[model samples]
Target: MISKDKPAALILIDIQKGFDNIEYWGGERNNPNAEENASAILKLWRENEFPIFHIQHCSSNPNSLLNENNEGNEFKEEVKPLAGEIVIKKNVNSAFIGTDLKQQLDAAKIETLVILGLTTDHCVSTTTRMAGNYGYETFLVSDATATFNKKGVDGQDFSAQLIHETALASLNGEFATVITTDFLKQNLL
Candidate 1:
């Protein structure tokens, strides 16, 4: 449980339409209710007037679904940033790599970060790892992130659920504390 006395920020990473393209991201995904969970957290953060940072991934690859010119580059309605909220755009997996996200968090005096978003094994994991390395207390909402199937180096196929679980497990104790959205709401509120 997080203490309400500490300042925290919600960092939503790459919750965009591009992730809806299952063909591009591989086959089926895990956590069908991920967007709903993200929405719930976003709503709670907004209602409490907590800082929220929306990370947008703009792929530099022209063939990528997340290309800046593509409609898929747009944010999903569920987690779109409202006016006055911060929106950081990046072409890399880690939001802090080429963006001012860290500086902004520092300036805002954010002691803790609640992170959730698309593709549990990708941007979400990368950002969480970086956040932990940068010395911020990070919480990853398990149900609020999803990932699609992937092919291993030996051509073995991996299920989306397996990938998601593995990613979360890798980050659980090292990068962030893995918690459910329900748990977060119950503890924070």
Candidate 2:
């Protein structure tokens, strides 16, 4: 368990409608209740008056489901940012790159981060790695993030669960302390 004494910020990354397009995203995904889990964490953060940051991914590729002009680019209803909450928009995977997310967190004197969102192997993983490298005590909510199937370099297919677990395994201990939303609620809430 992490120390609860330090100030913590909730970082929500790319929880958008684009992820709903399973076909566009390549195949079936893991964690059907990911949005609900994320919403639960968001509500806890809001209720406790913790700092919150919403990261929106605006893909540069026109064919991408996350393209700015596409309806799928819109944020999911569960994790939508309200007034006074910071929303960081980026075209890349890492939220820290090409964005003021680090500066904002630094300015707020955040010592820890509670992160969750769509595509666990992408934006969430990147941001968690960067956050760890930047010296923040980061906690990744495992069940709150989901990812779809993918093809490996050798044309081997990977299941969504495999990718998700692999990503979390890579991040655990090295990038962030991986925990479930239920654990967070039990301990922090």
Let me know the TM-score candidate 2 reaches against the reference structure: 0.96
Cα misplacement distance, residue 151 of candidate 1 (Å): 0.3
Per-residue CA lDDT of model 2 for 103-175, tens digit only, reads 9999988879999998899999999999999999999999999999999999999999999999999999998
- Candidate 1 backbone overlaps, count: 0
Candidate 1 global lDDT: 0.92
Over 1-189, each residue of candidate 1 has an lDDT whose tens digit, in order, gives 445566589999999998998878887899999999999999988887888999999999998889999999999998888999999999999999999999999998888999999889999999999999999999999999999999999999999999999999999999899999989988866
Best by TM-score: 1
Worst 10 residues of 1 by lDDT: 1-10
Clashing residue pairs in candidate 2 (N, C-alpha, C atoms within 3 angstroms): none
